[model samples]
Target: MSRHSEIKKTVLRGVYEDNAGIPRSTHGKRQSKFAADSQEPVHSSRYPGKAVLVAVLGLVALLGFNLRLVTVDVAGPAAMQVVEEQPLPSYRVQLPVPVSPVGALIPGNDQLVSPEPIQSLDDATITSGRYDTMLTRLGMPMADLFNLQVQTIVIDPGHGGIDPGATGHLGLKEKDVVLDIAKRLRDKLAVTGKYRVLLTREGDRKVFLKERVAFAKENRADLFISTHVNSLPPGAGSLNYVETYYFGPHTDQRSLELAEKENRDSDYAMGDFREVIARIGDTLKTEESKQLANSIHKHLYNNMKRRNRGLIDAGAKTGPFMVLLGVEVPSVLIEVSCISNKAEEARLSTPEYRDRIADYLKTGIVDYLEERAHRRTIEGGIIQNVAKQER
Candidate 1:
């Protein structure tokens, strides 16, 4: 071959042949033509796959960027989610301590002697009504009415100090009115020398419901009487009456409302009342309390009516009073008068009227004790006969 032709073939081989042995003569010629037409020189390399790889990488990056934009646009804003907060746990309520006069010890001379053993009686002749009638007709020797002699009585004046309960339109506080009556009652009972009387609080001070119960129990009281004055809403001016309550489930809405109001004075939260009521229902003296309440209501109504002709008969009621709960003896709460009424408030403010209330309450207490004694006497006789038969 000619030297010129050999040199030309060598140059062509360098430009067209790739390292991988692929022919790129046509691509090289097109690149050379493009370089000639443009101002810049064309670059040719043996590794043509590198250029293709770089172009493919650029295209993949652009496609990934576009896909990311599309994904962001399609997703938009996320839906707002709401999560409810959980309720906090309930805590126990703590009550305050009470301040009151300490109980006094009874003297040995004040104690009564035990009764003599009863003579054997025939059971065949004993019927409920006939036995009672015989005792009444024959005038049987009256022994002590109770298994034990009644001595101490506790009179609790409901609400005091910070708790000025059930304020009347004329600024008469239930605490003050009930305290005054309670003092009168205590004085009257004390003067008799037949019974020892104690007051839960002698002065105006805050006394917790549980504290009052504790005071009565600590004193070994035979009977518990809580005094309170009733009040109505401003709209219920005409609804004036006196009511008595014993510890039990409330019968009416009015009784329930009164209980709720009376129970509100404690430092403890009212939410605990449901638990308190449940507990009190199991521990109350149902029949004994009811009887005491009836007696007190009867005497109180009759006595008050004598002075005030239009006095209402607000019948004996059962309510879940916190103050009356946990009392060991027969317990009753008296709503002495409706202080909400203009006329009744005026009457209740008088010393003479309050003294009358105290007298009626004392009478009721005496009546209950007498009836209890009579029942115990008959029971004692029956028990003696049974003992003789057993022997």
Candidate 2:
């Protein structure tokens, strides 16, 4: 056979051997070198191993691609950021910082934001800037005016002119005694430069109850204090004491009779007093006047008792007097002493005693005003709290 025929026979022989599940080798073959080499047997096992290796590599590559897709940040690009963590929700409230009255609560963006946690309007705080007070936000001034201090005081010296009032046995006239006291008190208050003190009558002149009230009203007095001396009836025993009276219905028979004596003038009738009382609601005016009376009586009684033994504190009482009628401000009628008593009349006759009494009255008034200012501060705080809650 020719070499080409020999090569074809070698390939066909290998195919037939492989198909028949037989192993073929070139070891004993009698053929040319090319035919012998072509007759080498193919290993089916090796082919299957290479195929498996390729399939496994392809599967691994697919799995790796799927894992990359799952791990990618598709939502957004990575970026650097700084942020304040939001606080947990809370209903905690903190008291606002106490802002003094030295400066008005300026309604503007310039005011500082309260670092204190506050219950905000919409329950969430604005991260942009500070929070302003409700009043400031509304552009309303602080109600400091509502918390007023005692300024102008009207001192009415009772029983001037035709009315001599009660005269002591030593001829110590109630009008003269009280006028001196009022003048001394006015001077004392004026020297301090804290008050504007005015008298209804400067000298031993006549002044009607109506005129006195009108003077106080026209001047816009913050307080009205009428000074007087008390005397008992013929049968009543001489009593030495201090008494303070506020305008109201009589608290007792003695008060009623005293009111009658003080209300004798023709300026205001019983009907007029009735009208004034009817117009009053819930006795607020009466309560305020009573407070004034109590304050004065406390100081007057305490101070006088030091010098005058057995000096009684008859206590603050309510009595309707013409001088106090229709007077809007906190008013009181103080019976500084009893002219009916021999010792008290003797003391009233002296200038030193009168000066001392004036000093006591001044101190008492100062005490009342100080207490009132403190109370007003507390009330202002409450008003602020209410305003905060409302906001």
RMSD of each: 44.2, 42.3
Error of 1 at 189 (Å): 1.1
Candidate 2 lDDT tens digits, 1-391: 9999997996785454223321112123234445546656634331224344346435644654221111111111111111124332221212122233211111111112322122333432221121122222321112222455678999999988889899988888999999999999999989989899999999887777788889999998888999998897656536687899988766788887777787777455666677655444223345456556766786788789888777877878767777776687778999999898888899888999999999989987876666556544543443343333333
Pick the TM-score winner. Answer: 2
State the displacement of the C-alpha of residue 328, model 2, in Å, after optimal TM-score superposition.
0.6
Report the error of model 2 at residue 185, Å. Answer: 0.6
lDDT of 2 at 95: 19
Q: What is the lDDT of candidate 2?
A: 0.64
For candidate 1, lDDT tens digit of each residue in 146-255? 25777889999998999988787788888999999999999988888888899998899999888898999899887899999888787988667889998777888889
lDDT of each: 0.63, 0.64
Superposed Cα RMSD, model 2: 42.3
**Model 2 segments more than 4 A misplaced:** 1-145, 278-281
Q: For model 1, which pairs clash?
A: 145-373
